[model samples]
Target: MAENGFQGALTYIYDPAILLRLTSFQAEYKNGVTPLNPGETLKLRPLCLEDYDKGYLQLLSQLTSVGDVTREQFEDRFNKMKACDDTYYVTVIEDTTSKQVIGSATLVKEQKFIHRSTARARVEDVVVNDSYRGKQLGKVLVDVLVSLGRELGCYKVSLECKDHNVKFYTIFGFEAGKGQNYMQIRFFD
Candidate 1:
């Protein structure tokens, strides 16, 4: 349990299996996973109150191509997240040295409404600035968030991207559910 610690914090014990897995990951780096092209002065750190608007908005603007999220909408969502009860909230990436909001990732879990109780985490708002896209920052951000979701007992970590993003998610082992229904209500006035 202590094997996977919070970002920037050291875990207590040396779990051999975890260590071996990490070693194997690094050794097989270029085989399948998105290769981490060197980023400009970036660091993966926990989001802060200061990021609620600055870094958060910067990342949200990059979603212009995705055509669903907007800066104002992101702020509203961020406000809602701040006030939700049972929400696992955190922005798990940052670019400190460059002072740029290069990329970000978040996880939200909802309780099941059935007789059986379970929590399902949905990863959302994975964005990387235009300058950072080809560098594979999105994959790294999602990878970290998925790890957090599993650690917190999430039944599954699911996310949705545009149809054009199929190949990107495919490389990370995500598949369309065989018979799942997807519906959405855009806030149109």
Candidate 2:
């Protein structure tokens, strides 16, 4: 029997040995995973801690117009991502020779109670470096994410894009305004 703390919940400390074993297992799993590539030239892999710098570069390519992110803020977000990899599947495309992360996309799965507990995949932050555009890299990224959605047993996948890019995403079987407009309440300045 465990006593409740101030918040009316029990505080249980996990075994260090068990935690270490789990960490070791996760490391083994990560090592066996392969990088994905749509073409022979560029390769894609899940975002890792070592990608902090290059990942920032890829993000700046798309978000420079919106605002600037400080290194501390970026690292804080990265730390949270490290803990939430099960829900957030962010992939980066790399230049094979130079080993540069030239493109990035995120496929986040939202587990819901509706549809018999089916998950919904939201594809976000799809950006290709300016120098790497016009080579159908975006298509490759989206295709890979869609495949990942299926692999994760998601009921459906969706994304929001600019009106001009509606036709672009349509090629990926994404219909514009699928009976619902995207609504958001932003609290950021």
> Top model by TM-score, which number?
2
Indicate the TM-score of model 1.
Answer: 0.66
Which lDDT tens digits does candidate 2 get at residues 88-139? 7777676767667788788888998998998999999888888887666777
Q: Which regions of candidate 1 fall more than 4 Å away from where they truly are?
A: 1-40, 52-54, 64-86, 113-115
Which regions of candidate 2 deviate over 4 angstroms?
1-35, 39-41, 64-73
| TM-scores of the candidates in the order shown | 0.66, 0.71
Q: Candidate 1 residues 119-180, lDDT tens each?
A: 88887887788766666677766665566566656678788888898776665566888898
Per-model RMSD to reference: 7.2, 11.7
lDDT of 1 at 24: 12
TM-score of model 2 (CA atoms): 0.71
For candidate 2, list the clashing residue pairs, or say none.
none
